[model samples]
Target: MMESAFTRPVARPLVVFDGDCAFCTASIDRIRDRIRPDVDFAPWQRLDLTALGLTEEQVENAVQWIGSDGGRASGARAGAMLLRRAARPWRLLGTVMLIPPFSWLAAVVYCLIAHNRHRLPGGTLACAFPGPNRV
Candidate 1:
């Protein structure tokens, strides 16, 4: 049986993403396939950023994570945390991503993609909404 969102014994990390960004959505989907089933997926657009203790500007900048203890992590740090929550090989990859040079590179890559995602194949204005119109 699937676990209840509130009843899962372990504290599930929450991934706050851009619901309108096709690339971000697809990336989250891929990450979901690799991570623990308990992790939560929430769109920043649909959620109250303040409730998550995040500012609107921060959400627009990058994905964020709300830990069980209410600690926050953003950008590559958040990505690495999510990957580590996944199992095995992915965990190894997350570890590598945490390294100095690799982490720095990952952050830059994330920023570039985030800034230019609208021009990518799956990215378009329609992706901002949920419907068949999305690319």
Candidate 2:
């Protein structure tokens, strides 16, 4: 639903990230470096999430990935989807997530990070909202 610079009709997944969070930005940068050149990455904050039927609270709570058919994945599912799109070794890593124990572990980790992101060192006060000081 979010618009991106690289949308293709050929059916590839898109990653929607928190652009304002330094940690999220860094993670996305790493993912971009590893993924196939065609995968799409966009800032959820900059895009019109409401148009996408996603609330700001939802965007702030977790990373999201929209599959080719418009299905949505969140948290660890989103992470695995991203790795699967990266090809080969990364795909292998993503596949490991399908295992029950590992999948649960990944989900727990993702939830922890997502819930406490704002308290993390590089995550504090990193919002796209304009303050009163802005002209």
Candidate 3:
């Protein structure tokens, strides 16, 4: 039987991402170690995607954030959401990232980074897999 989202106890919001991608894992680790944001980070591999209203295809694409209240954000917005849960400077940046020009730039930057993540530091061949970008 699959566990539903309601059955899960979330002390904070959740950040879901592709586990198969080394870059993704490394990035999450950095966030955990450095940012220490008040959010739970999980690889899509270990969780029942359906329970989170997510799919392999969806998570395979870009980062996702699900709030304790079930609010969601994807891609750069997801990054913003995560930052908002973090400490001062980062939180402030996240807020600014949500504004018009900044949000637009973030989206573009995220797309470029996503497309070339395999070549980025900490990335691997696994990060190069072709997939749709839902964010």
- Name the top lDDT candidate: 3
Best-matching candidate per TM-score? 3
Score each candidate by Cα lDDT: 0.74, 0.73, 0.86
lDDT of 2 at 2: 43
Please identify model 3 stretches exceeding 4 Å from their true place. 1-6, 131-135
State the lDDT at 87 in candidate 3.
Answer: 94
The residue ranges of model 2 lying beyond 4 angstroms of the native Cα positions read 1-11, 35-38, 116-122, 127-135
**Model 3: per-residue lDDT, tens digit, 1-135?**
223353666668989888889888999999999999998888877887887788777787789998988898999999999999989999999999999999999999988988788999989988975645534
Q: Clash pairs of candidate 1?
A: none
Two-way lDDT contest, 1 vs 2, winner: 1
Model 1 per-residue lDDT at 115:
73
lDDT of 1 by residue, 21-132 (tens): 8878888887777565346888887775655568866876788987776777888888887787778887888888889999999899877777777777788874433334
Go through the candidates in order and give the C-alpha RMSD of each one to the true structure.
Answer: 5.9, 5.0, 3.7
Q: Which is the winner by TM-score between candidate 2 and candidate 3?
A: 3
